[model samples]
Target chain A: DTAVSQTPKYLVTQMGNDKSIKCEQNLGHDTMYWYKQDSKKFLKIMFSYNNKELIINETVPNRFSPKSPDKAHLNLHINSLELGDSAVYFCASSKTGWSSEKLFFGSGTQLSVL
Target chain B: AQSVTQLDSHVSVSEGTPVLLRCNYSSSYSPSLFWYVQHPNKGLQLLLKYTSAATLVKGINGFEAEFKKSETSFHLTKPSAHMSDAAEYFCVVSVGTGTASKLTFGTGTRLQVTL
Candidate 1:
């Protein structure tokens, strides 16, 4: 079974469009995170949720918001997506909120904003 | 705060040759370090992690890393290289306290192993 899974492995959308990426983890982890991999392949954390509560919020634009309905799911919604938003988004989860815990990552979703 | 730097952006090696990917880190407190491998179009996979454990930590796929506090380094090494080992490797560090803790990833190093 895939421990961490994200839907729509490839997404192509036009500028100013709204899109959402769904993520689910069956690892029974309490902490989930959203990371963005830019064109340079530099991964940066965007948001983190522990037990359905937002714990960490980076300097991401207000157009992007993460919603966690429960401990098992964390979804990212992007509003008025711009060309710069074209990048791979990864979903990850860990056993706890501790940084020492190893993370399980999904295959990643490639979003292209034309 | 904590951060990790991967010295080499790309490294090429021949089969059976030794492999070394350099990494340096800076942190205000004791840190947790990790090495992750990412094959093309795949998710990142944990190779090994060091969390106040032995200085020499061994991981799967015949990979290992040594944590040197004085040098502030956790470099991944392998005695022999296999073609299948070609991938992008990332050095990561996690620091801070409580639930506020966060992980910082290096730019990544692409490894090319030839037969």
Candidate 2:
């Protein structure tokens, strides 16, 4: 069984379009995170939530927003997606309270903005 | 703040040869270092991690890393390179104060294994 899963493994959209990517983790972890991998393969954390509460929100554009309805699910919504938004989005989860806890990542969603 | 630098953006190795991927890190506090590998069209997988424990940490698939505090380096090494070992490797550092912490990832090194 997949520990962490994300939907729409491949997404092709146009500029100014809106899209949402759903993620779920069954590892019973309390902390969930969203990371972005650019064309250069540089990974960066965009947001983090612990127990469904927002904890770390990086300097991402306001167009991108993350919502965690419950501790098990964290979804990302991008409004008016731009060309620069083309990248892979990875969802991960780890045990809470410790920062060094190892993360279990999903296969990732590849978003291509045309 | 914490950051990691992967010295080589790409490294090539021949089959049966040893592998080395260099990494350097800087953190305000004692850091938790990690090496993660990603195959094509796959998510990043944790190869090994160091959390103020043993300097040498072993990971899955015959991968290991040494955490050197004096040099602020956590370099990943393997005894031999296999064709399956070709992938992108990321060096990560995490610094925490109390209950809050963050992870910083390196630019990643793409390892190429040739026969």
Candidate 3:
């Protein structure tokens, strides 16, 4: 079974448009995270949810919002998407408490805002 | 503060040759280090991790990493390189525990395995 899965593997939209990326994990982990990878392949954490509660919120733009319907699902919604938002977004889940070191990552959603 | 540094931006090795990707990290508390590999257009995969346990950790695909606390280094090594090993490797460091834990990733090292 796929441990972590995210929808919309590729997204292409014009500027000022809105889009959303859905993510789910079947690893039965409590912590889920969203990371953004730039063109240089630099990965940065954007948000994290533990048991459906927001835990870590980085210095991302206000246009980006993350919604965790439950512990198994965390979705990202971006309003007024801009060209700078074009990047690969990854969803990851990890079993907290004992070891939060190992994170299972999704294939990733490549977003292109023209 | 926690940070990770991959000494090399890229490394190229021929098939069957030994491969080495150096990494260094800094953290205020007890740090758990990890090596993650990402193929082209793919997500990151865990290769190995070090958490105050064995200094030398073995991972899949004939890969291993030795943790040197004295030098704050966790370098990934493979006895033989395969073409499939061409991917970007990331060195990460985590300080906090449980849900509080956050990972700091290095810029990444792109490994090219040539035949």
Candidate 4:
């Protein structure tokens, strides 16, 4: 079974359009994270949720918001998307909030904004 | 703050040859280091990790890494390279002080294995 999974692996939308990417993990992990990888291959953390609670929210713009319906799922909703928002978004999960446990990542969802 | 640096943006090796990818990290506290590989059109896979358990860590696909605190380096090495091993590798570091463990990733090193 896929430990972590994200829906809509490929998304294409025009500017100012709203879209949402869904993610779920079945590893019984307490923490889940969202990472953005740009065209240059730089991977950066965007947000993290632990037990359905918002824990780490990086410098992402207010237009991007993450919602956790339960401990097993975290969804990203972007409003008024811009062209620069095009990139690959990855969802990851770990057993603990500590770094000792390795992170398991999803197949990634590529978001392309026009 | 924690940061990881992958010295080479790209590395090429022939089949049956030794594979080496250099990485260095900086952290205020005892950092947890990790190596993740991502094949084209795929997600990142954990290759190996260093959690102060052992300086030498072994991972899948005959890959290993040595963490050296003195040199502040954690480099990945493989005895032999296979064409199937061609992928992008990321060096990651994490600190434990924060409420949620966040990973700091390197710019990634693209490995090209040729016959």
DockQ of each: 0.84, 0.70, 0.67, 0.77
- Give me the displacement of residue A96 in model 2, in angstroms: 0.5
List ranges where model 3 is wrong by over 4 Å: A97-100
Best by TM-score: 1
**Model 4 TM-score (2 dp):** 0.98
Q: For residues B1-115, could you state the per-residue lDDT of candidate 4 as single tens digits?
A: 8898899999999999999999999999999999999999889999999999889999999999999999999999999999999999999998865557789999999999988
Model 3 residue pairs with clashes: none
Best-performing candidate as measured by DockQ: 1
Estimate TM-scores for all models: 0.99, 0.98, 0.97, 0.98
DockQ of 2: 0.70
Q: Report the CA-based lDDT of candidate 1 relative to the real structure.
A: 0.96
Per-candidate Cα lDDT values, in order, are: 0.96, 0.93, 0.93, 0.94
Give the best candidate by lDDT.
1
lDDT of 2 by residue, A19-106 (tens): 9999999999999999999999999999989999898899999999999999999999999999999999999988893767898999
lDDT of 4 by residue, A1-114 (tens): 999999989999999999999999999998999999999989999999999999999999999999999989999999999999999999999887787778999999999998
Among all windows of 10 consecutive residues in model 2 chain A, the one with the lowest summed lDDT is A94-103
True contacts kept of 1: 0.75
TM-score for model 1?
0.99
Q: What proportion of true contacts does candidate 3 retain?
A: 0.64
Instruction: Put the candidates in TM-score order, highest first.
Output: 1, 4, 2, 3
